[model samples]
Target: MPFVIILVVLTVPAAIFFCWYQMLVRKYKNSSFIMVYHKVDRYRGGLKGLCVSPEAFDRQMDYLYRRGYRAIPLGSLVDSIINKKDILPKTFVLTFDDGYENNYVNVLPVLKKYGWTATVFLNAGAIGQTVQYPMQPPEKHLTAEQIKEMSGRFDFEPHGITHRALTGLSDDEIREEAEGSKKVVEQLTGKDADIFCYPFGEYNGRVINLLKEAGYRASCTTLPGIVRQDADAYQLPRFEFKETKVWSPRYFFRNFDFYLRTFFAI
Candidate 1:
C-alpha cells in the first residue's frame, strides 16, 4: 500500500509537469525571438558579465541553423510589424548592445558563416573608449574602422550620445542624445539610422518623443516578451544571451518554467 501511494505521488507531479511543458511549446510555436547580446568575449563576473562565449554562440547559431531559422535585421523586423506585413516563419533577430570590440572580433565571423546581418547599438560619445565596470575587466567599444568594415553587414544604430539613463536627462539633453547619435551613426553606415536602443534599457516619454523627432522609427527595451505583429515599436523586448547559462537543450528543458515566465512575461 505504501509503494502504491509513493508511485501515485511521483507520477502525478510528473504528468502535470509534462502537460505544462507541452502547453508552453504550443503557445509560443509561431513567436519570433529577438536575441540580445552584449560582449561576445571571454567571460567575467559570471552571467552578470553579460558575455557569451564565442564557442557557445557558435553552437547556438548552429542549432538554430539546423532548425531552419533565418536571421534578419532589427529594423526590417520592426518595419514589417509596424506596417502589418506578413512575418516569415522561424525568423529571429540578433542585436548587440553597447557596441563591444569583441563583437567585431568574435561575433562577425560566426555571422558571416551564416550569411546573417545584425544590429549594433553604439553609444556615440564613447567611440574608441574602454568602459570600466566594478570588479570586472574594462571593455572596449567598437572603433570607427571596425564600424565602417561591418557597416554593410551590421546595421549600426544609435544607442545614445552617451550611455546614460535617458529618463534622468532633461528634454534638451534627451534630444541631443537622440538626434546627435542618429547623425553620427548615419554617417558611419551611410544609411538611415532609424532604430534606437535605450541606454541600459532605460527610457521615458520624453525620450520617446525626442527619438521620434530625431527620425527614429523604433527602439529596443530590455523587457521580456516574444515579438508579434502587434508589439510596440518603441518598446521592443529582448532576451539577452549571456554566458551565465549554456543554451543547450537540457538547460532549456530543465528550466522551461523559468524561460516560459521570462519569455512570455507571464
Candidate 2:
C-alpha cells in the first residue's frame, strides 16, 4: 500500500505536467512569433549571447526567406489584433532594441538585401552618444542623422529617455520617460511615436495607464511567447533570437522542438 501511494504521488504530478505541456503546444502552433534583436556585429567579446554576427543575421534572414516566412511590421500585427483580423501562419514581426548604431551599419544592409523592414526602439537620451551599460562596451547608439537616413526603412519608437525600469519610478517620472521619449522620437522622425517599448521590459499597471494617458497605442514587453489575438496591446510579448539558435542548424531544430514541446505540448 505504501509503494502504491508513492507511485500515485509521482504519477499525478507527471500527468498534470503532461496536460500543461499539451496546452502550450496548441497555443504555439496557432500564434505568431515576434522576434527581438539587439545588436548585429562581429565584435561582441563580452556580450556574445546578445549580439549576433552579421553573417548569422544574414543566414537567419535567408532561412526565413527560404522557408517562405512573411516578415511584417509591428503596426500591421497590432492592427490585426485591434480589428480582430486573422493573422496568417508563419507570420513574424522583427524588432530591434536599444537602437545601437550597428543597427544602421550592419543590420540595415542585411535587411535591405532581403527587402525587409524592422521596428527599432530607441533610447532617446542616448542618440549620437556612446552609451555603456554594465558588461557592455561603450558603443555608439544611433544618431539623429543616421536615423533620418534609414527612416524610410525602419520605424523608430520610444524606448524611454533613460533606459530605466518603469515600475521603479514615480508617477511623474513615468510620464517623463514615456511622453518625453515619444516627443523626442517624433521630433527626430517626423512621425508620431505610437508604440512604446518598456525599458528592460519592466512595467506595472501604472506604467501601462501612463502610456495610455500619453497617447501610446501599444507597448511591447520582454515576455517570451507567441502573440495571440487576445494578447494585451500594452503588454505584447516577444521572442529574443540569440546567436546560438540562429547559427547552428542542430541547435535551431532542438530549440524549435523544445519550443513546441514546452509551448504546445498537448
Candidate 3:
C-alpha cells in the first residue's frame, strides 16, 4: 500500500514537469483537454491501467470537484468547436470508450453523485459480447433503452459497429466502421451524434476524411496529449486514465498545468 502511495506521490512532480514542457515550452498556446476511460473496476492482477478501484476513482473525482472543474458533456465540446468559443478555466471533458454495462452499473452513479457529464462511445456489434482487451469477462453493453436513458446524462457516441481495427480495413470497410456507426446511433436514439472515437486510436488521412463525410464534428484517439484550439478537431488527442500505480489525487492536480501546456503551449 505504501509503495502504491509513494508511486502516486512521485508522479506529481513528473506530471508537473511534463506540463511545463508541453504547455509552457510548446508553441501552441490554446488549452483544452479530454480524459478517456474504458472501464472503472477494482484493481486486479496488479493491473495498473484499468483506472480501477472505487477509492482511487473517488479521489480523482474529488480532486476535480475541489478544483472547481466542470465536467462538460462531449456534445457541448462539439458545439464549442463549431461556435469557436473559449472553454472556461479548468474546463475538462470526460469520455468513456466502450459502452461497458458496468459504466451503467457503476460509473453512472459516481458521475451522478458528482453532478458530472461524460460521453460514452459504444461499439454496436459488441453490445452483448465478450470483451477483447484487458480480458474483462463477458458483459452486456448498455441496452438501447438504457443508453437512451443515460443519454439524458451523457452523450452516447459511436466507437464503431464492431470494435475492429480501422487501420486493417479497406476504404469501404472503413466507411462501414465510421459512417455505419453514425447511422446506427442515429437510428437508435433518433438524435444525430457528431462525435466519434477510433477503435484503438487507429486512423489515417483517409479515415479522417471518412469521419468528415460521415458528418462527425470531432473524433478522439488513443494518443496521449491534450486538445487545443488549433489542434485538429478530428484526431483530437486524449489522455487515457489507466489504473496505474503512479496514480494519485495530487499527481492529477499537478498535471493540470501540464495538460494545459500540452493543449495550449506553443
Candidate 4:
C-alpha cells in the first residue's frame, strides 16, 4: 500500500508535467533558445562535467528531433532578430565552446544524422595544434584542415586567442584576443565571423566595445535565460544541460519555470 501510494503521488505529477510539455511543444513551436555544450566524447576523464558521451549525445539528439526541436546557426538567429524577422519555431542554437577535436571526430557525425549543424567558438591560439593544460592530459583542438573539412556542418566562431577572460585585459590586449582571433577564423573559414562567445563567459563594457570594434554582431554569455526579441545582444544569455539526464522531468520543471517567467510573464 505504501509503495502504491508513492507511485501514485509520483505518476500524477509526471502525467501533468508531460501534458504541460506537450502543450508547450505546440505553443512555442516557433520559438528559439540557445543550448550550450562542450565535448561530445565517451571520455570518462576527471574534470569533464561539461562533456557529453557520444551515445548520450546521440540519444539526446534523437529526443530533440522527435520533440520537434531543431538546430540553427547563431548568426542566422541573430540576423533574424536584427532584421526584425520572425524566428523559426522549435529551433535552438547549437553551440560548443573550446572547439575540441572531438567535435570533428565525434559530434559531426551525430549532427549529420539529424541534418543539424553547430557553431563552435574556437580557442584561436590552439588552432591546428594540441591544447595543453597545467594539470590535465593534452587534448588536441580542431585543426585548420579538419575545420575546413567540416565547414559544411559547422560555423567556427572566435572564442579568444588564449581562452582568457576579456574583462581583465586592456583595450589593445582585448583587440589582439578578440580581433586577432576573428582574423584567424575568417581566413580559415573564408566567411566573416559575426557572432562570438565570451571565453569563460566573461566580458564587460570595455570588452563589449572591443568586440564591436572588431565587427562582431553579437556575443553569447553563460547567463541562464531564454532569448527573446528584446534581449541585449552583447549580454545574450545561454543555457546548458548540466547533467546527462537530458529531457528528464527535473529539467522539464526547470525549463517550465523559466518558460513561465519568460514567455508568460510569471
- Root-mean-square deviation (CA) per prediction: 5.3, 7.0, 8.9, 6.2
lDDT string, candidate 2, 1-266, tens digits: 99999999999999999987777656655457778889898765666778988888888788777766767888888887777788766778889999999999998887788788889999999999998887887888998999999987799999999999999999999999989999999999999899999988899899999999999989999877678887889989887778755547755663463345333322
Instruction: List per-prediction Cα lDDT, in the order shown.
Output: 0.81, 0.84, 0.74, 0.80
lDDT of 3 by residue, 1-266 (tens): 99999998999889998986765644434356788887677544433565466666777777777766668877666666667776455667888888877777778888899888888998977765555554544555778777877876788889998888888888899888888888888888788878889987889888888878878888888876666666678877876665563457655664554444434323
Per-residue error at 115 for model 1, in Å?
1.4
| TM-score of model 2 vs. true structure | 0.82
TM-score to native of every candidate shown: 0.81, 0.82, 0.79, 0.82
Lowest lDDT 10-mer window, candidate 2?
A: 257-266
Candidate 1 residue lDDT tens string, 129-181? 89874555778889999999987788889988878899999988888889999
Q: Which stretches of candidate 2 lie over 4 Å from their true place?
A: 1-30, 244-266
- The candidate scoring highest on lDDT is 2
Q: Which regions of candidate 4 fall more than 4 Å away from where they truly are?
A: 1-30, 244-266
Answer with 1 or 3, whichever has the higher TM-score. Answer: 1
Candidate 4 lDDT for residue 265? 21
Give me the overall lDDT of model 4: 0.80
Give residue 145's error in model 1 in angstroms.
1.2
